[model samples]
Target chain A: MPALILFWILAIVCIGAALTMVTAANPVRSALSLVVCFLALAVYYVTLSAQFIGAVQVVVYAGAVMVLFLFVIMLLNLGAPVTSSTKGSNQNTAAVALGAILLLVLFISGIFFEIPGKAVSPATAQAQGTVKAVGLTLYNPHLPWLFPFEATSLLLLVAVVGAIVMTRRQV
Target chain B: MLTGLVAYWDNLRDGIYRLFIFPEYWHGIRLPALVPYVALAGIFAFTLGILPMLIWIERVVIGLMQDRTGPNRLGPRGLLQPPADVLKLFFKEDIQPGSIDVRLYYLAPFISMLVALSAGAVIPLQTVTFRNVHGGLYTVPVTPGNVNIGLLFMLAASSLGVYGIILAGWSSNNKYSLLGGLRASAQIISYELAMGLSLLCVVLLAGSVQLDHIVNAQNTLPFGIHWLPSFLKGSIFSWYWLQSLIVPVVIYTVAMIAETNRAPFDLPEAESELVAGFHTEYTSMKFATFFAGEYVNMLMICGLNASVFWGGWLPPFNCFPFTFIPGFVWYILKVMMGIFFYTWLRATLPRLRYDALMNLGWKRMLPLALVWLFLLAGYSLVRTATAPHITPTAVVTVAHVAPGR
Candidate 1:
C-alpha cells in the first residue's frame, strides 16, 4: 500500500516537472523543472532495481547535464524571455496534434495490456541482476547485440566528424 | 541456537537478493524492510558527513606537507573545524543576485548535492546481511549488484557531472561563470572518453565487468603465483596496479583528475582568473551544495580509480591465517589515499594555462588511452590462444599432475 502511494507521488512529480520544463516562462525555471523530472526518473530507476542507473541519473542528468544547459542559456545573456519563435506555422500545429495522438494511443494500450502479476519469488530475484548476470546476458545469447552496439560507434563517429566539418570554415 | 541463527541469516540473504534483482519484490516488501532502507539512509548520511572531515583532512595534510600548521583553532588539531564551517554556512543568508536567473541559480546547488549524494547508492559501503521480506531467509550479497555495466554506469554519470558546473556557470549570468561552465563541460566530455578506454584495458583482461571479479582476477598472477601476497607462503606480484597496463591506469588517473576539475585542471573555478568561477554568485546553503558536491566528486573519482586499477577492497595478502579487517575498510583506506594524492597535487602544482589543459587532455592522455586499449585487447587475444585446450578429464589430470609430479 505504501509502495503504491510512493510510486503515485513520484509519478505525479515526474509529470508535473516535465510539464513545468515545457511551460516555465524563465529558462532557469525550465532547467530546474528538468532536474525535478530527473530526480523522479532516478527514483523510478531505483524502484526498477537499476540501482547504478538510478544513481547515475541523479548524478549526471540532474546534477551535471542540467547545469550545463543552464550554463549555456545563462552565458548567452538570456533572460525570462528566451528566443521563442511565435512563427508557429500549421506544420508545428500538425506535429503537436500527431504527438498528442501518439500519446493517446500509448495511454490506451497501457490500459488494455494488463500484465499478469509475477512476484520476485524472493530467492531467484536476489541472486539475479548482479554485474555477472548482466555480463552473461550481454555476451552470451544476446552476443549478437554487440555488433549493433559497435556499429552505433560508427554513427557517433560520423556525427562528430559532421559536427566538426560544419563548425569549421575555410580561412 | 545455530539453527535459529542460520534461519535468520537465510532470511536476510534472501531479502537483499530480492532488493537488487527482483526490484518488484523489493517494492512489494519495502514496508517491512524499513530497517534496510534506514541502513541505506545511514550510508548516504555517512557519504556526506565524512566529506567535510575529508576537506579538513586535506587541509591538514597539505599543511603538513608544506611545513605549516593548519586549522589549529576549532577543537584539537582542528578536528571540529569541518563542523564549525558547516554551522557557519548553515546560518549564512542566501544571496540572490538581482540580474541572474533566480530558478537555475537556486537549483544549481541542489543539483550538485543530489549528484554527489546519489553516487553513494551503488557503492558498497559494507558487506551487508539482511532479512528477505518474502522468503523469510537471508538475501545478502558478498558484493552489491556485481552488475557488468558498473563501469559504464559510472562513466555515464561522471560525464553528467560536467553539466552541473556548466549550469552553475551559465545561470550566474557572469562572463567568468559562463566561460568556466563551457570549459568544464568540454573538458569533462573529452577526458571521460580517455577514462573509459583506459579502464577498458582492465575489462578486456578480466573478460568480466563486475568489480569483485576484477579484484579476484588480480589476486592471482599470470604465471599462477599471487606475487604480492606476503602472508601466504609463496604468492608473488599480482596486483593490476602493477600490471604492464599500468600505463593506461596512469593515463586514466590523470584523466580522472581533469574530469573532477581539481588542482591544475580546476580552471572552471579558477579564483585568479574567474573570481571563484561558476559558483561565484552562489552564497549560503546553495554554495554549500556546490562545495559538498565537489568533495563528493573527489570521493567518487577516488573510489573509481581504486576499483578499476587497485583491487578495491581486497587487502594486500595471499591468505591471512586470521582475517580481522573488512572489505569496506580497505575500500575507504584506498579512497583516502587517492584523495590525499589529489590534495598533494593541488598543494604542489601550479594551475595549467587553459590552452595547456586542453592540449594535455587531447594530445597526451587521449592518445595514450586509445593505444593502451588496443594493446590490452591484443594481449588478451594472445593469452586466450595460448591457454592449453582441455577436456574435463584433462582438467582433473592437470590438477592431480601438479601435486603428484
Candidate 2:
C-alpha cells in the first residue's frame, strides 16, 4: 500500500513536470523541469523492479543528456523569454501541425498499445534486471533482438563522426 | 555484553558512519536489527566529520611540501582549527546578490553537496557479518544497501554533480562565474567518458559492478592469472592494475583527478583567471559546503580507487601475519595513501593551461581509454576461446535449519 501511494505521488510529479517543461517561458526552467520529469520516470522504473533501467535512465537521460542540453542553452545565452522562431512563418505552422499529429499518435498509442512479454514473477524480474542477467540476454547469439542492440553501436559511431565534423573548424 | 557491542561497532566504524551517527541504543524495544542502521548512521557521521581533518591534512601536507609551517595557532598543532572555521562559516551572513537567480543559486550548492555526499551509499568500507550484544544475526554493509548496480549508481550520481557547478555559475550573474561553470561542465563531461571506460575494464575483470564483489574478485590472484606459479599468487602485487596491465588504472587515476577538479585540472577555478570561479558569489555555509564537498569528494574518489584498485577492507595478505589489525584499519591505511597521492600531485604539479587541459582530456585520455578497452575485451575473448574447459563436480551438502518470518 505504501509503495502504491509513493507510485501515485511520483506519477503526479511526472505529469506536472512534463506540463511545466512544455509551458515554462524560460528555456532553462523548461530544461530543469524535463530533468525532474526524467527523475520521476526513473523512480517509476525502480518501482517496476527495472533497477538497471532506472539507474541508466537517470545516468543517461537526467545526468548526461540534460547536462549537455543545459550546456548548449547556457552557451547560447538563451535564458531570456524564449521567442518563437519567426512567428507566423510557414515553418512555424508546419511545426505546430507536426506537433499536433505527434501528440495525437502518442494519445492513441497510450490507449491501444500493449507490450508483448509475459509477466515474470517478482523474483524473476529482479534477477532479470541484474547486470549479469542483462548481459546474458543481450549477448545471447540466438536471441532475435541482438541485431537492434548491435545497430545501437553503429548509430553511436555515426553520431560521434557527425560531432567531429561539425566541430572540426572550431578545434 | 558491552565488549561485544564494541566488537560489532568497531567493524562498522569506517569513514561516513562514525562522526555524525550516535548509534542510539534501542535496547528496550528489542528491535531485531536496529544495531546496523544505528552503526550506519554513525558511519555517515564519520564521513562528514572527517572532512575538517582532510582539509587540515591537505593544508599541512601541502605546507610541508612547500617548506612552510601551516595553521599552528589554534589548539595543539591546529587541531581545533577546523571547528573554528566551521563556526565562523556558520555565523557569516548569506549574502544574496540583487541580480542573481534566487532559486537556482540556493539549490546549486545543495545539489553539489548532495551529489558529493550520496556517492558514499555504494562504497563498501568492509564486510560486516558481526553479531550484536543481543545475539541478533544481521550483516550491515558498509554501503547502505546491496544494489546490483553499485558502481554504476555512484557514477550516475557523480555525473549529476556537474549540475551544481553549472547552475551555480549560470545563476551567479557574473561573467567570471558563468565562465567557471561552463569550464566545469565541459571538463566533467569530457573526463567522465574516460572514467567510465576505465571503470568498464575493471567491471569486465571483476565480473560484477558490485563494489564488494570487485574487492572479492581481487582477493584471488589478480586478473584471474591462475596459471601463476603457486608462490606468486595471492599477494599484494596481484592487485588488479598490476595483473591486467596498468592502462586502465592509469587512465582511471588521471580521469578521477580531473573529475574532482583537483589542482592540475582545476580550470574551472583557475585563480589567476576566473577569480574565485563558480563559488565567487557564495558566502557563509554555501561557500563552506562547496569547500567541504570538494574534500569529501576527494576522500570518496580515494576510497573508491582503493576498493576498485587495491583490496578495500581486505588486508594485503589473505594469509596474514598481519591479522592482529581489523579490516577497517587496513581500509584507512590504503585510503590515506590515495589521499597522499592527491596531495603529492598538488604540491608537485602546476595547473594545466586551459587548452592543454582540454587537449589532454579529449585528444589523449579519451583515445587511450577506448584503445585499452578494445584490447582488454579482445584479450578476454581470446583467452576464453583458447583456454582449457573444466567441468564442475557437484559436492552438495544440504542442511536444514529453522526458517520463519
Interface root-mean-square deviation (Å) of every model: 9.5, 8.0
**Model 2 Cα shift for residue B316 (angstroms):** 1.4
lDDT of 1 by residue, B232-254 (tens): 32122455666545797788788
Candidate with best TM-score: 2
lDDT tens digits by residue: candidate 2, B110-142: 888888888877777675554456655454456
lDDT of 2 at B14: 40
Docking class of 2: acceptable
* DockQ score for model 2: 0.47
List lDDT for all candidates, in order: 0.69, 0.79
Each model's DockQ?
0.20, 0.47
Q: Name the regions of candidate 1 deviating beyond 4 angstroms.
A: A1-11, A25-80, A83-147, B1-46, B73-75, B125-149, B226-236, B319-323, B388-405
Q: TM-score of predicted model 1?
A: 0.75
